[model samples]
Target chain A: MKKLIFIFVLLIFSFSYAYQFYGIPYLQQVNDFSLINQDGKKIKFSDFKGKYLLVFFGYTYCPDVCPTSMLRISDVLDELGDYKKYVKVLFISVDPERDTPKALKKFISFYDKTGKYIVGLTGKPEDIKKVAKQFRAFYQKVPVKNKEVGYLVDHSAYIYLVDPKGIIRMIYRPDNDDPKRIAEDIKQIIKMFGTGE
Target chain B: MKKFIIFLLTGFIFLAYGNEIIIKDPWIRAVPPSSKNTALFMTIVNKSDKQDTLISVKTDIAKIVMIHKTVEENGIMKMKHVDSLSIPPHSEVKLKPGGLHIMIMGLKRPIKEGEEVKINLFFKNSGNIEILAPVLRR
Candidate 1:
C-alpha cells in the first residue's frame, strides 16, 4: 500500500508540470501557396521542404505591430544563433496592392538583418485571403479618408511553429518579452522526447 | 519572508499602498503628412496600496481625448473605445502600439512637423505626469 501511494503521488506531480512545456499546438497548419518573395522569385511554401516555420502575417504600412513583432522575431533568431540551422521564418503580406514583389523585398531587409532572409510573399488579395484562412489567421483593413491610400491592417498575432513535415507543432501567442525565449521554446519542442540529457 | 510580506501588505491599507501606477515608455508614432490622429503608449506601474485610475489625458495638440485598444478579430485590426483604465498595486499595465493606446482625436490645428506635443496625463490619485512627444514625420 505504501509503494502504490508513492507511485500515485509521483504520477500526479509529473502530469501537472510536464504538460505546459512548449508552445501551443494548433488544429491545422498552412501548406501549399505560391507567393512572390522579396527577390521577386515566385516561390511556394513547399519549397521550404524540411525546416521549422515561424509564420506571421502583416503589411509594410503597419505602424507598430509588424515592426515590433518582426524585430522581436529577429531577436529570437539572433538568440537562436546556430540553432537557426533548424529554423526558417516566413512572413506573408496581407496588403498585396502596395506591397509589390519589390516592396516586400525592401521591407524585410529593413527589419531582419541576418540575411538568412525572411521570405516576404504577396499575391492577389483573394489568394492572400485563402492562405491566411487555411492557417486560421485574420486580417482587415481600417481605411481612413485619403489617408495616404493606406490605413491600418489588423491580423492575428500567432507565431506558428511547424515541424519538419510542415505540420504545426505549436503556436505562440502575442508576447513581447525576449526573442531568445522563443528560440528556446522552439528548441524545446524539437528536443521533445529526445535526449536533452 | 512570505509571511512577512503578507503582514506588511495588510498593514498599509489606506491613503496609498505601492509606489507604482505610473505609465512608462509612453509614445506615439510620428504622424503622416496629411494625418491628424496620433497614438500614445506607456506602461502603468502601480506600486502604491490604493487602486488608481487613469481618468483623462490632456495635450496641447488635440481637441478631443479618448482611450482605445486595438484588437484582432478574424484577422482584422479594430480600434475601439476603452473606459477608465485601472492600475493595481504591485502590477504594471503597458500601453503599447497594438494594445492599449491613447487616441488624440481632432487636432486643434496642424501639428507642424519637427514640433512637439506636450501631453499631460491625469490619474485618479490626482498625480500628474507630463511628457513631451516629438512630432516628426517618421
Candidate 2:
C-alpha cells in the first residue's frame, strides 16, 4: 500500500511538468563569448555552467525602454520566489564608450540594488559587435543636432533566453513584459528540464 | 416660457466653463510584442486663470500610469517617478520625448504603429480631461 501511494504522487507530478516555457525553437547552438564584469574580472559565458540566462543589449542612455524592462526582469526574478537559484540575467552593454565598468555598476544598481546575482559587462565596440552579430543584433548611432557628445542608439530590443549548456534555447521578448507570466513560463522550463522547480 | 428660459441659461453657463486643459497631441511609442513597457507624451495647455496641477493620469491600456521626469545630471539621463507637475495660469506645458513625459508600465498588450491609446488626465482644479494618444514609430 505504501509503494502504491508513492507511485500515484509521482504520476501526478510528471503530468503537471510536461509543458516547457522556453527552449531553442530552431535548434541553433548558443554562441560563446569572453567578457568582463563591473569589477573588471574576466569571465566567459561558459562559466555559467548550470543555469539559464536572460540576455539584453542596450545602452544606459535609453531613457524609457531599457530601465523599464530591467525593472520587470528583476520583478520576474522576485516572482520566481525560490527558483532564482536556477536562472541568471546577463546585462551586456552595446554602448562600450560610455558604459564603462563604473558606469555599468551604477546603472545596474538602480534596478538590482541588492546585486546578489546580476552581471554587467562593457567592452570595445569591435568585441561588442562580434558578440552582437553572433546573437543577431543590429546597432547604430542616431545623431542629435547641436549635441557635442553622446547620441541616441538604435538597436534590437529582443531579450534572449539561453539554456544551461550555454546553447541557444529560446528567446524571451520584452514585448509583453508580464513578469508573473514570464516567471511562470521560466518555472515551467526548469521543471521540464528535470530541475523540479 | 419662464422654465424654458431658465433651462437655456443653465446650458449656456456650462458651455462657457472652458477652464479645462486641452491635451493637443498624445502618444505611446511602440515596442516589440514581448515588452511590458511603453512611454506616453502629450502637450497640455491650461486655458483658465487659476493655477492647476496634473493630479493623476489614467489609461485603459496600461496597468499603472506614472508621471516621470528625465533629469540630466553630469551629462547622464536618469528616470524617476514624479508626483506632479505644476501648470501656472494660462501656460502651455509640453511633455515630449527626451524630456518630461509619462511612463506607462504593465501594458495590457503590445501596441502597434498607428494605433491610438485613450488617456484620461485628472487635474486638481479642472476635474477630468481626455485625450487620444497615437502610437509613434521610432
State each candidate's chain A TM-score. 0.82, 0.83
CA RMSD of each candidate after superposition? 11.7, 13.5
TM-score of chain B of 2: 0.84
Shift of residue B64 alpha carbon in model 2, Å:
25
Per-residue CA lDDT of model 1 for A35-140, tens digit only, reads 7887878888888867777888877666456656777777777787667777788889988897887776666765565557477888889989998888788887
Residue-level error in angstroms, candidate 1, position B137: 17
- Residue A170's C-alpha lDDT in candidate 1? 64
Minimum summed lDDT over a 10-residue window in model 1 chain A is located at: A188-197
Using TM-score as the measure, the top candidate is: 1
Which stretches of model 1 miss by more than 4 angstroms? A1-19, A27-29, A175-178, A192-197, B1-24, B28-39, B43-68, B72-77, B81-94, B102-130, B133-138
lDDT of all the models against the reference?
0.69, 0.70
Q: In candidate 1, what are the lDDT values of residues B40-136, reduced to their tens digit?
A: 7778788876677888888877766677787766434566668788877667888876678887755656565556578988887847878776654
